[model samples]
Structure formats: C-alpha cells, structure tokens
Target: MSEGSSSLPLVAIVGPTGSGKSELALQLAERFGGEAVNADSMQFYRGMDIGTAKLPEAERRGIPHHLMDFLGVREDTTVAAFQHMARTAIADIRSRGRLPILVGGSGLYNRAAIDVLEFPGTDPAVRAALEHELELRGLPVLMARLQDVDPVSAERIGDAKRVVRALEVFELTGRPFSSFMPERQYVVPTIQIGLNGDRAELHGRLAARVHGMVDAGLMDEVASLIPEGLREGRTARKALGYEQFLRVLDGESTVARASEETIVATRQFARRQITWFRADPRVQWLDWSQAGLGGAAEALVANSGVAGA
Candidate 1:
C-alpha cells in the first residue's frame, strides 16, 4: 500500500498480559466512539472464558466488542483467518463512522493488522500430513525442523503450537515462513498504544488475577466444559488455566499446585509478549499506572488525527 493509502487512522491498544489493555481499550472506545476488536488468540473461542481472561459483556460497559467468543473450542482458527475477519470488521466500523480499536496482547494479530503479511494459502492434504507428523513425532521434532529450515520464523514463533503452524505453511507453500512477512515500510498507519508497568508489580497482579479466576469458579468452568465434550478439544486442552486445571481434575496435581504452575506459565507468556511488542518500533509505549485512560485516549486521538473523535 502507498503511504497515502496506508494513512488511514486506526487505533491499536496492545501490551503483555496483565497490562490493563482491556480496561483502557473499553474506556477509549466509550469516549471516542470506537469499537473494541479482539486481537487475543485464546479469547476467540467460546467456553474458554476464565482462562482467556475474556471480558464479559457486562464488563464491556455497553461499548460494542467484536470478535470475542464466536468460535467453538473444537474449531481451528488461524492467524490468517483472524486477519481477514479483522480487516472486514475494521472496514465496517470505519464505514459506520466509528473508530476501530484493535486490542489485546497477541503480537501476530497486531502485526497482521498493522503490516501486510500474506498468509500462505491452506492445503488440506498438506495440513493433514503436518497434523499426522504432529501426532506421531510430536511438537519438539517439528519445531527443531522449523529451526533448521527457517530460523527467523522459528525464533518468532517459539512455542509448539506456533511451530506447528509455521511448518504447516512451509510444507504447503514450499516457501520459507519468513518470506510471508511484509516489509517494514509496508506497515499500515495506526496509532499503537502499548501498556506496561513494573515487572514485579505486573507479576503480583497476574498471580492475583489467577487466584481471582479460581475464586470466580475457573475450575467449575473447566469442569462444565469437560462434560460438554471439550475434554479432547484443542482449544480447551491448551488454554493456560484450563490446561493446568485439567491436571488438577485428573488428580495429577493439587489445586494449589495447579494455580502456582498456571501463574508461572502465564508470567512466562507475558514476558514473551513484552519481548515481542518491545522489538517493534511502531508501538508508542505508555505506562498505564502513570496515566489514566482518558489521557491515553486523548493522546492517541491527537496523534492519529482521526476525525470526529
């Protein structure tokens, strides 16, 4: 896209987990007539609630939210698919004369919205073969292969799940995964707001959040999903809190241990998110504890020059 073409005003609220991105997005959307769009991968699935830290409708405070809880636990939703959906949602929101606020901590999703990464087209046969390999050799072997074939992508997509996806694209398209990434200059015009705070404070907040989820019946939510046939579903099985809670349900770990493990894993994930967003120069870092939502919203509006804000 040309500089003029890419200059459309879009607001993106992003950060690591427990950074208070959601609350800030809600406040900004309400104040500026914007719609909150989900950029979190886990929050897309239904019944994966407490583990995803999904914002409930009540918590939305009457501001419109797009792309939350629309898919089943068993469904396979890829980042490319999310990008297509997000493009449509953003266009629709802009068409209706409202701002589009891309929100959450998913770096890939944020990158897709702001950059021109073209996803390799899917092939069922190739996907089946990759899935078979995943089932047989497991994720470590596949991840190792990815590191050999496409080290940049291997570094970017470090986890087992993301490694599988990168390999699937490589196998299907016969192209290096890094080739699909658009050039830096091709990034879309967006006001990127990054929320962050002191690391120790954020960790304490994350632990508290995990405990709060437990108090709010996180285990019961997982238990309910198991009976509804989500016991083997990928979405339910891999979610942070739900996965650990499943271990507790299976009597492999006590609730206390599960909570502790979940908190640790979540903290690690947040650190990864922070690393990813920090590497991107487009984001304008903001300390949520230092500034209120109103101040952040005003700054974003002024910087982006979005009309009617």
Candidate 2:
C-alpha cells in the first residue's frame, strides 16, 4: 500500500506447469535480493509436497518463501483471503528492503496478488438457494442458466461449485461474476516474467514430471495423508494427482491408470494456465529454454523503472 516505501519492483514468474517458473523465481530472487511469495493455490496445503511439486527446503537455496505449507488439508482459502495475505507478504518483504518475487502457475491467484481487484460480498441465503437449485436441477441446468445471465462467466467456469457461486453473485449483486475479473491494472510497481516453450516439448516435460512424481512415492504420500483426513478435504482431495491416487488407494483404480489419468489432467490444467496468462498483455514472455534466462530477467527488472533492482 505504501508506494514509496520500497525501491524494488514486485516480480512475478508465471507459466504453465513444468515450465521452470519455480527455479526462475529463485534465481531472480537471489539476484535481486528478494523473497519468494507463493501464488500457487495447491501449494498452500501442508503435506501436499509431491503432487504440488513444492520445492523442498534445501532446494529453496536459503531464500525465504512465504505463504506455503500453511494450511491444513481440510481448510479452504478464498481468493480474497489469499489476496490480502499475499499483499501483506509483499509489503513486509519490501519493508525489509527486499524484492518480492511471486511465483506460480495459478493464474487467478497471481493476479489477486498484484492486480487491483476487489471481491464482492457473499450472502449465505443466496448461496444456499443456489446450492439447493444445483442439487435439484443439476449442474448442466444451472450452467445453462448462467450462460443466459452471465455468458462470460459461464464460458470460463466449469465446475459445479463455481457455477453456483457465479449464479449467486448475479442474483445478489445484479452483476455478472465476470465483471469482477481482474483488469490488467497493477496495484503496485510490478513486472511479470512468463515462461513458455514448444508445446510438444512442454507435453513431454509434463508427462515425465507426472511419472517422476509416481516414482517419488506420490502414492505413499497420499497414503500417509489419508489418515490426516485427506479425503475429507474439499479442495485438497480434488488436486490432480491426489484425486487419482485416492482412487487407487480405494481399490477403485490401479496406480498405472491413476498415473495416466493424472498426466492427462495435468496437461489440461497447463493448457488452461497458458490461456489465462497469455491473455494478459502486461506479461513479458520469455522462452523456458532461453539462454541466460536469469540474466535476461534481471535486465528486465533493472530497466523496469523501479527505484532499485
């Protein structure tokens, strides 16, 4: 909130899954004397390391990372909560005379951190009625209704819960949920570095990453968390690999099948992420395989018009 308090630009590293965003964030933070603030929604949960591809502490290379591993599996965080927390982290990092480098593929969460967006209030009664309608009329019916009332939101939202929420917002506020979507306006001095590469190469990397997670004991990790009420967790249970692996644990699916499903799901997720970030003209995209990528990013920061780099 203090515009003149810090001299460093708020840096964000964004890209699809398996595009080296995390490593790039670390390199830039180290170069600019910054701390890493997580915008990845899944990485917020504790004990979700393998599936989320969270960097182990040693791999963090002594850079202090914020807003990670802070939530119980069963806890749910709204975008509003994340926005407040992320802004607070950025302000704190700047107060300490350090740059704040945000890193994640969760597009909305990334925007919430640096964009001038405000969430609308929720009404329990309105939400309850929508939920009741969803149960009675089903998702497709509600989704169709949303298409009529707020076609932009309907096109973007797919899941049952979000569809219901969108309808609720429309009913309560007489405004489309898409009206609240973040504009390309920054709340602070910021620079976004987006990583991308050949689509086929990215697919191969993602598949290999999923297989690597399986080999790294993703099943065992899920097994360990089951006793911790992983199944009861609303959002955590739905994570890509965890969801499939949970089926395997229930004897409803085989690990190989789950792995394959996870690969497919992860690839789809990456595509969505790509679409989300690519639409933002403010982002400066760099290839993941660019030579001297770290140095190139540093040069961007240096020329970003921030007081200090």
> Which candidate gets the maximum lDDT versus the true structure?
2
Can you give the TM-score per candidate against the true fold? 0.92, 0.94
Model 1 clashing-pair count: 0
User: What is the C-alpha lDDT profile of model 2 across 1-309, one tens digit per residue?
Assistant: 244457667999999999999899888877777799999999999999999999999999999999999998988888889999999999989987788999999888899899999988888899889888887889999999999999998877677767888898899899999999855798888999999999999999999999999999999999999888899887899898999999999999998999999999999989989998998998999998989988888888878864354
Q: What is the Cα-based lDDT of residue 128 in candidate 2?
A: 83
lDDT of each: 0.81, 0.89
Show how many residue pairs clash in every candidate, following the order shown: 0, 0
Sequence-dependent TM-score of model 2: 0.94
In candidate 2 the C-alpha lDDT for residue 272 amounts to 87
